[model samples]
Target: MARRSTPAKKKKTAPRGKTKTGKKPPKKPGGFKRLMLGAAMVAGAVSAIIAAASMLELDRAAHKAVNDLAKSSPAPDTSDRTDQPKQSDMDFSKGYDAPNRPGYMVERVPEGENPQNDTETIPEPRVNPAPKVAPLPSPEKGFGAGTELAWQKFATHVPDTGNAPVIAIIIDDAGIDKPRTERAAELPAPITLSFLPYATHLPEQVATARKRGHEIMLHMPMEPTSRVVDPGPHALLTSYDKVAILNEMSWMLDRFTGYVGVNNHMGSKFTADPERMAVVMQVMKARGLMFLDSRTSAKSVGYQEAQKFDVPAIERDVFLDDADDAAKISQMLDRVESVASKRGYAVAIGHPRDLTLEALNKWIPKMQAAGFVFVPATDIIRRNGVKVTG
Candidate 1:
């Protein structure tokens, strides 16, 4: 009891991890410190947003600068012939239809016959009746050796350009837009124009395009990978037997005159089927028409089949305006340049969009300056894997 009196009341100590109130201690800053941390976090978020907005504004400014530069650049258009009549003159000229031909000849009903009495008076077939047999042009003996069985009549005229890179730009999906298609035809000599057989005014439009120094190719509709991708009404399908596929192809091939070849509109599925494609290439060769493997699908065997069948064939190198941005289209043309540089020639396909047209308008001059020659699609084809020449 005498020693316990000296051992005074023990000094109380706080728990290691708890407050005096028996709760968890504040492990991190709190109160004024916590408020300061929250403020710092909010300020950082705002700074990040401002930086993003600034970056976006810089990108927009860069695009604007590019657009302005393109506009300011002078385009030397040698494509437009000095002798050619003005657009105003052409518009008022007597021949609105340049190569005026009886498009889809039809049997006229007797004028006096009553509609009820007469057989179902059919509206004229959209296309002219296809020729049952149009003999393929046999190769002339002049070119010798590898050139046998090749047809030059269908080939577009190419100047003796030596060994310069040749570029073929084919505008597909023509005939739907009369004005734009016609305008494209007038772009430059040797720009290939591929017309859709099902379009209503194909014959007239094709004639005009051909008259304007553009080479022609039939844009044949074919089955794609997905059922949702409707190529068109009479598209060639993998489901079709040889006879049916050939029949539909014949109709498309015979749609118009003066085409160098046929190219698929959307044949991702049909082109891969060797059986169907073999029939198509055989028919193509037999008809004196070359074939362009649109290369819509990576699995397509069209080029190989054409090689095996000795059918003149080439594959599309670039597709312009897959996105309708003018700058992007110009970039695709740059791809065309790379292809042409590598392979001695290249083939690019584009639609009649404003961007495509604009890009071409700017690019044609630049390409010419670069010493690349623009040729037709047929010029680059090969027979038996041998480059064909007339």
Candidate 2:
């Protein structure tokens, strides 16, 4: 028993595919090869991400290029649009060239932008605006020396009393204030009414004035000494060229008819310029129109130029409403009587203000009773020893 030894334990052995306990042995872990496979998958994913990012950058660049190109492109051509202005509409550089069309003196501006249908806003001319065109032909060239013109054809009739101190009371600035103008027209007969060409409904207004037995004249606007005082639309500025001057004159003259002559509206500065006055006198001669120099300026050469061109002209001797007061107007009327008494005739200018009209209403009768005759302005021109020729 002492030497009893257990049989030697033999190592247990399974078949080739079995474990010692009759099961297969566990598989060994794959090391480097598996790691390599995992690494490859990760690299493929990273490449896909980078490719997507590059595609996004390219798309952004393309979009930016397209936007820039669109920005650089020009606007679409609208030349075919009917609302656009034409190239030959006007020569805005020289001045506002009135449309060759006959109507009110409308300024030619771009369509739909504050169209000046009534009047033009003229700037203060600082220099001679006359273009270097040939001078107008001599007065004897166009209408022969003896053609009967408007001044004679349309002259108001007045009995020729030899040196009887005739008084011509001219109402300037007529047709603007319709009520006052109508009242003035009703005051007396043969009150020489100088109407502004820009007045509305000129034909009708003038017809009414003429029906009331008032003589008519065109109150041609000219440049004044003060820039603040506007001379209205299409004024005859000293800066206007001969062509422009003629065009403006044409527009004014064509407004209405049956006017005996024209007188300066507010020609303080224009009447003083001899050259401009000469040009105007030539027009007067051509139109067979008389010139009544308002004589707003002391140095006016309008009378002299009229004589040079053989235009029948007269000057204003007294202003009836210079002060706009009834007493002052009465005094001025007295002065007119004095002047008429001394010089055998006088031309007094007044406006259509109520005070002037009222004063005239009372004074005309007084003067009529005092043996002073009231005549049209043209009669006074004839009284000045200048023969009225057609």
Q: Report the poorest 10 consecutive residues by lDDT, candidate 2.
A: 126-135
RMSD of each: 25.3, 27.9
Worst 10 residues of 1 by lDDT: 100-109
lDDT of 2 by residue, 1-390 (tens): 478778998996656765567766667658987899899999999999999999999979856744443343233233443432211223222221223311112112223432112112222331212111122223464567556667776777767665455788889888766777788888755789998887767799888888777789999888766554556777787775455566678789999998988898876777887866776776787677888887776667888888777777777777777566888888888888876665566678898887888888888888888878888877765554445553
lDDT score, residue 239, model 1? 67
lDDT of each: 0.65, 0.69
lDDT of 1 by residue, 149-219 (tens): 42455566667566677788989877756677777887855788888776666778877876777788888
The local lDDT score (0 to 100) that residue 34 gets in candidate 2 is 86
Supply every candidate's count of residue pairs whose N, Cα or C atoms clash at under 3 angstroms.
0, 2
TM-score of every candidate relative to the true structure: 0.60, 0.63
With a 3 Å backbone cut-off (N, CA, C), the pairs that clash in candidate 1 are none
Predict model 1's lDDT versus the native: 0.65
Off by over 4 Å in 1: 1-151, 382-390
Over all chains combined, what TM-score does candidate 1 have? 0.60
